[model samples]
Target: MAKKLGLKQKYQMMTRGLGWDTTYQSMDKVYPFDKFEGIKVHDWDAWEDPFRLTMDSYWKLQAEKERKLYAVIDSFAQNNGHLGISDPRYLNAVKLFIQGVSPLEYMAHRHFAHVARNIRGIGPAVAAQMQSLDELRHAQTQIHTISHYNKFFDGIHEWRHMHDRVWYLSVPKSFFDDAVTAGPFEFLTAISFSFEYLLTNLLFVPFMSGAAYNGDLATVTFGFSAQSDESRHMTLGLEVIKFLLEQDEANVPIIQRWLDKWFWRGYRLLTLVAMMMDYLLPKKIMSWQEAWEMYYEEAGGALFQDLARYGIKEPMSAAVARKEKNRLSSEAWAIFYQYTHAAAFHTWDIDEEHKAWLAEKYPETFDKLYRPRLDFWEKEAAAGRRFYNNALPQLCTVCQIPMGFTEPDDPTTICFRESEYKGEHYHFCSDGCKGIFDNEPEKYVQSWLPVHQIFQGNCGGASVEDVLKWYRMNLGADNLDFSGSPEDKFWSEWHRTASRAEAAE
Candidate 1:
């Protein structure tokens, strides 16, 4: 074998060295100027992607990864859902994970497809294409893997439509839509840099590791596959930021504002991920507090420190987010508990072990504030009936999560704030999401809250089963309504199989 080139070296050669032309070719002719903005680019060679794998090696690795991944997915499906340690109740976390993240992968595909087309430089453009394809693969593989769960549960169907139209779905949607609508440079800063490069480790790694812990092999595999691509995307983000900053001084403030807004926005969306990591996934990987401590508090803190030398200040709201991250896992878990009836997954009362974990992870404010609520819910659960509230809380017009989050420093009660524009009242979960809404209420107002959709008679039918059927959900016997329905047959059969396996063992 020849002496190996590192990823950085390959990236430098394929993307960075592409524009190293010595001959007198007019730079403007080579990189045509677009008059969308007044920014002038004197040299395009300054653009560089840090992770340097070219098309051939990129596709080869991705293909091999997918081959291995799909083999595991198929094997897991054939062997029944792989996590023996994970009870059905644990899938509530899975449902939320699929809901919050898988769809975003698809959105990444779409937006990256656009980015691949729009970027002016060939090297960056090609890299964008690789990322674009990677994202599309991620979306497909996620959906395929999760579709197995769809056969057994009711959570993931209609996610694309739900993403566009559902209320809670709006939290992520509004964040991405904002990035999509912004100018090209700002879009890069908003999505590629702040959201992907800086914060993605916080979002994906813990969950993947947790999936492994929880016996969710498929999810773990998919998470890893997507994350491998994320490193490249992060490189693109870093490159975009440096390239934009070096190109012109005026772009700094614009990039800075985009950084601030998207960082907070992306951070808020990761709240769902935090909850999933802490309370949703069985055999918890790492606490949100721990992940935040490592990823955001340590890695992000260092990155911001590094950027400080460039006059790129830390996001204005990062401190508040860091403070909230300490408490948001349990806080968000409460929201998930209150609302999971509407989700495809089921939520169980937080047990003693989980409570202990919470206490350890959140030393400052776990038992004193949140335990009482868990106790009450547990008591209600133990008393024969699991409390499944059907009432839909009014969703924020933008973020779409129910109005359950309280103001910072006061997590004891729900917080709801509204703004009036012309005639209509637009609701927001917090000042951050609210500020985003107020800045562009017209855009946020166009959101499709799924609860609102159900109320509006836009979904398929009057009954839950009809709605499920309408949404293309194919419920199996085990996942069928335990309340005496035909779908219960699957559960009966699964139980019978479990009985046989136990008896055999």
Candidate 2:
């Protein structure tokens, strides 16, 4: 009997060999999106497949991961893993992941499938097809993994509804929405190259390692299951850039512009993650600045040096993000602290330990710039007058975050930038956001700013309670300070019961 074909042969047969030139329609008509972005692809044949992952092998590998993931999840749940976390506050980080990041996984699945169908190259099509599946699986596993917490937690119960309607969640929703709505190349450049490769570590750390450090076994396992595929996606991102850059010299500037825009957009989106790392995690990992230096500065610096051959420099935002790192987490936590009353997640008073952590992590800036406001909040909460910014905040027209971030150069004052576009004035949190708007004013102008929608009386009604109901958030359960929350009471009772049991023993 003849031997079965090897993996490489099967991969080629399944991917490259399956594609054919159209007979009835022109290639341009069939692959119209491939060229409209002004990207010249002289030979799609020159594109290299980053991985020789055939569908048969792909299914087997994913099945194994699913088995391992579910097994760990089962063990964790049956053993009551949620009770083992370092603190209930840690669950807020998990809450942020579900509402903000997990949905993006599903969005990524849709966009990867889009590029798979739309991009002309067979190699990328296969890569994107696999990545689409990876994303879908990631979304599924993340939901299943974190759903275990939903039973024990309040804010986690209504997530998908909250993601679409919540004020803070608009940051991630708008970020992904911008990518998916763009042309094929720009989508790939924004998501694949910029988000997945350039800055994924900054994302993975705060949630994944944070989970492990805090003893949420299900989420930790979920992170482990997704890690290998994330590595592959990272490889594909690099390949996407090389193929585009080396295909034509004209592609250089277009690609560079995308890198800069996405880098900034991604950095802004990560403000939430920065807060998670610094404030939400009960157990500390490296500070956001430490992670940024390792991930973005040193590691990304080496990547840009390699890509410099292809005429790509590190994104202009990298320098700005470098300067903002010290202040990023502190500022982000403050936003959550003030707005926690309106958010799906809970924010607690920053105790002295956490305050000290912030001081140690952000020695130069935290004490002078942020602590005064933080101390005020802590003191006010203790005095029975917890501050909630009752008024709706003005969101940046581009990034869609409340315009709270201060100047990177001058950390004390709010950084504001605006432009007159087609007669309407649009505000931005920073020059980075404003530059993105200036580049594509028409695209951003149509942004569905949630705060504006609420003012326009589109989000259920004008009352805070009415809007929260529309967001499907439980009245007192999901939105509030954590000090006297249901979760807080449950946690305290749990420990008290345990202590009684130990005494009886």
Candidate 3:
């Protein structure tokens, strides 16, 4: 054999010799969108991907992992694996995944494709290309993994439509849409740094662990597989942030602004995740407050300390986020519990045991601030009347979540902020959302707010049933209280039948 090539040499050979001088057209004309964002890239070659992956090696590794993943999926499907889950209630977490998160993978795929094509450097471009494929794979695998559950579940069949039209889903959709619409550098900063590196573990870990604890083997497999790729994506995020900061001191403030804005946006989007972790899973892994402290406060504290050498401090409103960690999950679940009839997922009052668990998990806030509300709801439920908030709740113009979050200092009052643009009033759920809108009013004013669309006759007809029909919700089956719902009835009957067979044997 001839001389063997080293990994770094092969990466360079594949990435370095790919670009050509353009005498026929100007560089700016070729890449028109790169300059408008005010990013300064003095040397494109200065950008280095830490992964050092060539296309050949990349395909080989990905193919092997996917083959292993599909093998597990097939085995699960042929054996009636759905019956082995901890409870039917656990599938609600899967429904939330397919509805709220799977489509985001596809959106990430689309944006990464744009980044791959538009950016001028070969190293970054190739990295983006790999990430684009990784995201597309994640979307497909998530859907494929969850499709087995759809054979027996209610809310999963219409997830694509639900992602577009559901009220809670608008939170994630709007957050990704904000990132996808920005210029290239800002898009990378928004997604790669803020979302993937800083906040992704908080989103993925609990769901994966919950799946495992609930005996959903297929979901656990897929979650683990998707997270393996997340490591590379996280590396890419850190590299990009450092590369930008190293390139020019002027790039610092712009990145810090994007960091602050996207950090809060990503946190607000995770409010749904917090609720799912705390309230939805039948067998809980860790409390939302504990997970936040472990993942965000402890780990993120170290990350910021490392970045501080480059003049990057923690995000603005870090204090508010820290304070709300104790309270956001309860607040979000309460909103879902009241308005669940208008949603695609199910919700119900936690029993006394679960309430005690909450008290133990959130000693500072649960019994004092949140448990009384749960107590009142449980009483109402016992007396043969369940409380439901029928009137439409106002949505934040930016994040598109309901205005149910309370002020940080005083947890009694809802934190509401407003701005007037062109003599039309706009409302925000917090100062963070208002700040995002004020900085880019033109962008957010054009938001396709779900509530506004429902009122203006754009989403089905004007009635709640009409709106539910538009969302493809199955009413009593898919939405609303889960105590006596189809899923609950099925689970009870499942265990009862198994017991009867055992006794007969």
Candidate 4:
């Protein structure tokens, strides 16, 4: 905060200024060469987290920032600032944010905590510890940012319990769970390298921009502050990959496959964010197509080109990634529309403007594949019937996302991968989950699917009402309909006062 420090300057602070070489260095460095696989490290310093600040500097800045932000959230909620938003339509975007992202940050916190514990390198380990705290801060900041909306929204209260036992919640739970169980190198690849470095902007930036457009300063500030931290997290991910590659030749092939597998897996999982960007945000920041083309296709494409000099092939070949990106927005929208009643967010039919946006953004497939369904839904809405179908189909055991993804590049075909282990069947949402399960069926089967929990009577009861009550108490599912909540009451009264003030003026 003293002055604007660019990435290079920060790197110098952490890796150069604080880095010390001792003459009495132990025979084995804190991060030793991999003897079992015959991997050798030419130089550990080659592994560098680009956004480098020492632990003391990191904590001081981060703590001061969090204190300021949390105070804002407290003031906003207490003073009924949610009513000051430009329109109720803005809440729709915030609702989507709470549902899709808030819980994921918590999960990321858990995994980063684990990484801080288990990783061998003192430098990487300490960096991960800093990230572990950063993630928890992110989780808290997200909750606080959205809690103002929570006062007015229906589903914000029960998020924590839902994250563990809700069917949709499993998407994030499974993603992080997969990482937590992997070898140290792989955990780094999955979480730090692939998700943070490559695709996190796809998840966070649009929502922040939308919040800004919709006149939600708290959400925008919180998002930017957290993303400022993400710059560091991304550097850690890139550094982990570089360190692994340089550590051992034997590590290269293994790391390559992980890079391929995880990049696709994380990208596929981010379809929810893609859908949220396109449909849920009332004010469009950018279409999912545009974001993906720029962020994934161009930026990620360039990163792969640079990595190729080190014998690293682009993970998840460009042809397949491009194909997936083309279909991701509309396909994810269809799935979200189908299942949103069970979700914390609400879904509405695509209006003519939304359709026009889609047509412009996704020219090739929108008209042919998804438009008819949108038309049908619009008609259904016009018939005095709001759609609210809450029944869920079977869920994937591994990824925990719904079984809605269609086969790669084939939007018409449902993409569900199945594997049998020891005479039992395990389901996956995509090839990524399937491959992960196959690699370790023993691990995947132990996943705590929410639906399975209900069947096992671990939740409230077999009855739907009983289950809902249990979900409310455990998962923070408080007053879900805004019109009936205290936030709505405050909003109504504030508007009335505003009208009186205008007349008095």
Q: Estimate candidate 3's alpha-carbon lDDT, on a 0 to 1 scale.
A: 0.89
Kindly list the per-residue Cα lDDT of model 4 for residues 1-505, writing each as its tens digit: 6586666666566545554544577545543422333345566566565555677688799888988887888787777677667666457667656765677777778777776655444577668888888888887888878876765656667677666665666777677767766766677788899889988878777777878877787898798788778888888988888787777677788878788778877876777778778876767888887898888889998988888877898864445557766577777766667655455555667779888988888888889988998898778767865454567567777666667777776878988778989999888877777876797688878988877888899878887566767656322233232323444466677799877977999
lDDT of 1 by residue, 1-505 (tens): 3488777776666666554543587544554423254544556666655665687687789889989999988998988863353655555556666666777777777877776666567677777778778878987998888888777655566666556554456677767777777655666777788888988887778767777777778888888877778887888898888777778787677667677778878887888888888777767777887888888878888888877756799887777786677678787777667655444445557779888988998888888888988898778767765565557677777666777677776777677788998798788777777777777677777777767777788877666656555555444422222333333345667878887998998
Query: In model 4, which regions exceed 4 Å deviation?
Result: 1-46, 49-52, 67-79, 473-497
Error of 4 at 91 (Å): 2.5
**Model 2 TM-score (2 dp):** 0.98
Best by TM-score: 2
Clashes found in each candidate (C-alpha, N, C closer than 3 A): 14, 0, 0, 6
lDDT (CA) for every model shown?
0.72, 0.89, 0.89, 0.72
Ranking by TM-score, best first?
A: 2, 3, 4, 1
Clashes by residue pair, model 4? 154-480, 157-476, 158-475, 158-476, 158-477, 406-415
* lDDT for each residue of candidate 2 in 338-358, tens digit (9 for 90 to 100): 888899899987778888988
What are the TM-scores, per candidate, against the unseen true structure? 0.84, 0.98, 0.97, 0.84
Off by over 4 Å in 2: 1-3, 499-505
lDDT of 3 at 47: 83
lDDT of 2: 0.89
Q: lDDT, candidate 3, residue 493?
A: 81
